[model samples]
Target: MKHLTEEDLVLLYYSEPEAPAHGQLHLRDCPECRGAAESLALTLNVCSEWVVPEPDAELGRSVWAQIAPQLEVQGGSHAKRHWARHLWGRPRPWLWVAPALLALLLGTFYLGRVSKRVESPVMAGLSNAARQRILAISLADHLDRAEMLLTEISNAGDSGAADISSARYRAQDMVDEGRLMRQSLAEQGDTATLALVDEVERFLLEMANSPDNANAAEVQSIRQRIDSGSLLFKVRIIESNLRTEGQKS
Candidate 1:
């Protein structure tokens, strides 16, 4: 039996028109898929209670005003036009996915805040155990992905001038997610976990800033940094502990 992909589950979760009816049927018939759907629902339901702040209406226009002039001076009319198309054109897959992922991470942060400051009955009803499980699951998943990316780079043995644009893109997302997790961990006063996230964020920042096609030396440098600090080992250790906590919760 074929399981529904994550993308399929996400679309189904949102009740997007694009989601096929068979997905709902399959979810009912397949215990694995049903469990996966339930997990997604749990996370989303918890996050829905956390309110995200609205952005300033002028923020986008203001930032554009600052950068538009520079774009023209640097690349002339063609560059500015290209950027305009890229920004305002039909949305790309990454464009859609990035915002959702960011919202999920931000939701984790806001959820923590709401639990502390708000006295709403709905918020009060969510058990502390539930909250711990959510945080543990989120952090464990984040660290697992981070570990995979770092391991890939570290094991890029002697591959000359590899195209690492994919890794770079992933690193950029990780950097954003890591910062939110770091903020959440700090608020909870988990100093040890906070320190690990700090180190991971720094390394992820370095990866995010790396060139698309990094040369052998650049690759080795990243690997050395990861290895020197034993970051992967530490991430795995914490991830294992989180999984245990998540299960117990």
Candidate 2:
């Protein structure tokens, strides 16, 4: 016979009304399963002694009185008895499923709010000059963070196991940021801006895809590319120019 799962034993021990009949049959014929069920029962019996706040008798009666009318409304005793059986039959599934559904609903609503804010109408309503200022400011912030991530990796000292994991993840995020900014610049036919953004994305992709626990040699190789190509210098200059132009607008 297959050994009973802990979940199966727990439901049997608790004597859940909906516990499967197969479980009951297995417990009778299977000594191993029966022993497990007995141990679980002992544990649960101990837990049942935990102290719980008791309602005042008067309040309990008053609350019962209020609900009694509703319960009585589903026809007389026979109809009410069937309703009661189904209501008490299996509440555990709903205990979990209800909260999961509620959380999913809340998550969807919150994400919708964030999406609206990111695609804000305020930016869209701005004049052509104002829009450039907004783009410049947003692009400047993205480049600043990207430069920091690259600089951190470039300046990492040759040592034992260097964890560039955080930098790697940040660079991944910057790749997405750069993609969006690059698209904005492309719409304006800004070749210079687009070229620099493409270079930034290229290096960011390299950093993001690399292993987190990079050794000293790996760190040096990345830094060498940045140095040889003046990648960091170009980003810094472009970021500064965007900020300067943003201020003028």
Candidate 3:
């Protein structure tokens, strides 16, 4: 019969079945196999008797250092192996540092772009609203000043020509402001504002073109036009409405 192997002896020493049936029958019948198994058991027990020393913390680093060279040879690429080596021992400062700084800088740049994009719509809305408010308030103020001018013209004393240059200059200035407002309104096809501005424009142009020093006849003629058009009342109402709308906006 063939002798049992060292493996069979080890299994027999541990009482592990090497075969399901007639297991170790040869070992039981043969003195040589039996002796070999007992000898293996004795050797194993003697090895177990030697106390294993506990490893220190440095043992882990020592083991990785020992394997690092073999890993580098198998890893293939010089750059990749260099990076992997950094994972075991003290990494060169720039290895992790440069990549971390690059990531942070990229993150900040992308974040700034996102924030500006996110805020654009809101900022645009605010700017448009502010422009509208300014236009509304300006138009209201212009109307208030024009209303005063027309009132003065309508109620002027009939005494033969005083220095009417102030009123004429004021009328020319109003015309200028009114012309700009009218052009803007006309472009938008605002028929209502156009109508009021038309009435105010006629008064302003007439006053601006009339002689600097005017007679009672001219003053009366202008008053007649103001009364006929109800220009003052119309401007006052429109100005009041615009101011209220501007406030709400």
Among the numbered candidates, top lDDT falls to 1
- Candidate 2 has a TM-score of 0.51
Model 2, span 131-166: residue lDDT tens: 667567666766766677678777676674588877
The lDDT, on a scale of 0 to 1, for candidate 2 is 0.68
lDDT of 1 by residue, 1-249 (tens): 989988899999999998977999999899999999999999999999998788888999998996764442221111123433554474333322322333444464576567866454443555666666666776777787788788878777566677777778778877876776777677678898889999998998899899998998888888889989999999999999987997893
Tens-digit lDDT track for model 3 on 1-249?
A: 777777766666677765323437887898998888778878899988999788886998998986665352231112233433543354343322222322233333345467865333322444545645545665676676678778777666667554466668667766765765665566446689679888888888899888877787777788788888888889999989877866874
Model 2 misses residue 138 by how many Å?
0.8
143 Cα displacement, candidate 3 (Å): 0.8
Error of 2 at 105 (Å): 28
Q: Identify the candidate with maximal TM-score.
A: 1
Give the CA lDDT, 0 to 100, for residue 211 in model 3.
84
Model 2: pairs clashing at backbone N, Cα or C within 3 Å: none
Q: After superposition, how far is residue 173 of candidate 1 from its true place, in Å?
A: 0.5
Model 2 alpha-carbon miss at residue 189, Å: 1.1
Stretches of candidate 2 above 4 Å error?
1-121
Q: lDDT, candidate 3, residue 59? A: 95
lDDT (0 to 1) per candidate: 0.73, 0.68, 0.64
After superposition, candidate 3 runs with Cα above 4 Å error: 1-129
Q: Residue 99 of model 2: what lDDT?
A: 23
Candidate 3: global Cα-lDDT?
A: 0.64
